[model samples]
Target: MLIAPWFTITVLAGIMIAALLAIQRSGQSRYDSLVTELEQTRVALAQTKATCEERSEKKELEITVINASLNREIAERMQTEAHAKKLRKQFELILNSAGEGILGLDTDGNFIFVNTAAALMVGYEPTELIGRSHHELIHHSKPDGSPLHTGECLIQQAYRDGVVHSSSTDVFWTKDGASFPVEYVSTPITENGDIRGAVVVFRDLSAFEP
Candidate 1:
């Protein structure tokens, strides 16, 4: 009986060892399958990363183009403003430096602009003449001390015809209601065929009072 019991115990132990080995093999097979799936997942992730990088590159290129276009537009605007400033300065200089007295009037027969020489010739402060009518200030009279209403006043002619060549007039009025002889070259100011004002340049010739 003792030998038979020992033999049964030995067979049971061998069967248990065989079952453990089979379970270990199955576990190893499952681990191999898992490793293969993980590798496939890694490859898919790499492809996704590459696609994202390409899209990022495209976005960067578009941003670069937009920045360059904005910079060019800003540069052009700055250049235009600088050019306008230079032209305004030039006009001021030319008007002030002229030898002849220059007067600029608005379309409504009001004084709008003038140079330093013009004020000196008219014997009034330059600011006083602004917003004042030219006709009320500068009507011509004859040399015989009478109010001279000659042909057409230069200022009115300039406003009407929108142009004036050289016309020599020999009479004008002063601030103190004194009559004098003068010569004038007058014209209208225009831009694009639109009249902005009248301009008249005059010089007193009464000094030759022969």
Candidate 2:
């Protein structure tokens, strides 16, 4: 059977149009899928950025806390040192203002400190008496010019017994080798039932004698 030429041409054009429509639909579907994937990737990146920001904030907070603690500790230590220095200055003022001779000793009978009166009584400066042996400097002899042993000294006895010893008959020698009568009280310094040293307070009795 012979078909019409115009009819065949119209049928071929219709098939070509359908094929082009199908390709356009397939490209549209592929573009939609790509858009969805891009949206998911963007959401994942935002979450990761938020997590990194949170961790950075936490680290900054930790550093701030540590710095604050260190600053507080340093301030407290400086305050303590200032308080201790003030106390030491007050102690020195009191000792220098005292009338009676004051001598401080360590456990081994070494002179740790001496007040102004003590240095004047011995005819020496306060610095000269520091670190000197107490027994050798002023307590070396008895009133009768006899040798006084360390064991027989009343001050030594006070250290051993951890008690106060007072004697009006004791004698202390001066730097010029002159002897004078002294009334001294030796009291042991103790801490927690342990004797550390002695404090000797003395006055010259020559002025008081009638």
Candidate 3:
């Protein structure tokens, strides 16, 4: 009934070798799976980096285009303003050099512009006449020292009727309260067929009078 010693030793050695082989196979399989997962993670990171880089480049391009457009608009606006300023200076020079007394009035009969000849004839500085009421300053009374009503003023009527009023018998008062006859033409200023105000061109009749 007893087993041989050599057989028992050979069987025990075979079992140990089988167990060690099984463990090595399992460890190799797990190592392969870990390597695969690491590769996938690296690929995902590279894709994310590429997407971010593309978005940054697109945003930078948009910003550059916007800045260029803004710069162009600013340059155009400055050029337009410079041209307007030049035109305004030329207009002022022309008005000042005119021989006739010329003045501009607003819708309410206030003086908006008074040229050199107009200011001198009215005995006022150009600045002093501007913003002052035209009727109150120069056309407030008749030649006989009677108050002239605003409703009866021909200059006011010209703009109200959108017509030209010419008169040689009108009287305009000076700063010293002296009345002088004036030959004047009141023309309405119209824009888009709408009357805005009036411009008065006048000549002093003092030298011609007796």
Candidate 4:
């Protein structure tokens, strides 16, 4: 059998048209898949950025709290120091204004503080008596001109026993090697129920005598 020329041409055109349509449909499907994947990626990136911002905000808040606490502690310490200094000045003024001779000794019987009246009565400057052994400076001898032992001194006893002692016949030697009668009371200074030192208050008996 022989085919006609028109029929052969028609068959070739139909095959070409079908091939073109299949190619266009395949390209459209691929494009739709790519768009769906890109949308999913964008949503994941947005969630990650939000989580990072929240963590950064939380860390910043913690740092601010820590700084505030440190600042408060520093301010409280400064205030406490200032109050202590003011109290020390008040104590110094009171000691200078006292009429009786006052002496403060350390645990080792060394002079730690001597008021103005005490220094004047002993004929020495306040600076001269500080850090010196109290027994060596003025309490070395008795009223009868006998050598006094440290073990027998009442001031030393006060420091050891945490007691108060009073004497009306004791003598304290002056800086110029002279002696004067003194009536003194020695009392222990205590902290936390422990004896730390002694404080001596003395009056010149010569002033009371005619």
lDDT for each residue of candidate 3 in 185-210, tens digit (9 for 90 to 100)? 77776655766677777778886767
Top candidate, metric lDDT: 4
Q: Of the pair 1 and 2, which is ahead by lDDT?
A: 2
At residue 123, what lDDT does model 3 achieve? 93
Give TM per candidate. 0.52, 0.61, 0.62, 0.62
Task: Identify the superior model by TM-score, candidate 1 or candidate 2.
Answer: 2
List runs of model 1 lying over 4 Å from the truth: 1-90, 140-151, 207-210
Show where candidate 3 strays beyond 4 Å: 1-81
RMSD of each: 44.1, 43.5, 43.1, 43.6
Q: Which residue pairs in candidate 3 collide?
A: none
lDDT (0-100) at residue 198 of candidate 3?
A: 75
* Candidate 4 lDDT, 82-139, residue by residue in tens: 6545654565566667667777777789886677888999999989998899999999
RMSD of 3: 43.1
Error of 4 at 20 (Å): 99
- C-alpha lDDT score of every prediction, in listed order: 0.59, 0.68, 0.69, 0.70
Candidate 4 colliding pairs, count: 0
Alpha carbon lDDT at 170, candidate 2: 88
**lDDT of each residue in 97-162, candidate 2, tens digit only:** 766777777678888667788788888787877888889989999999999999889888777898
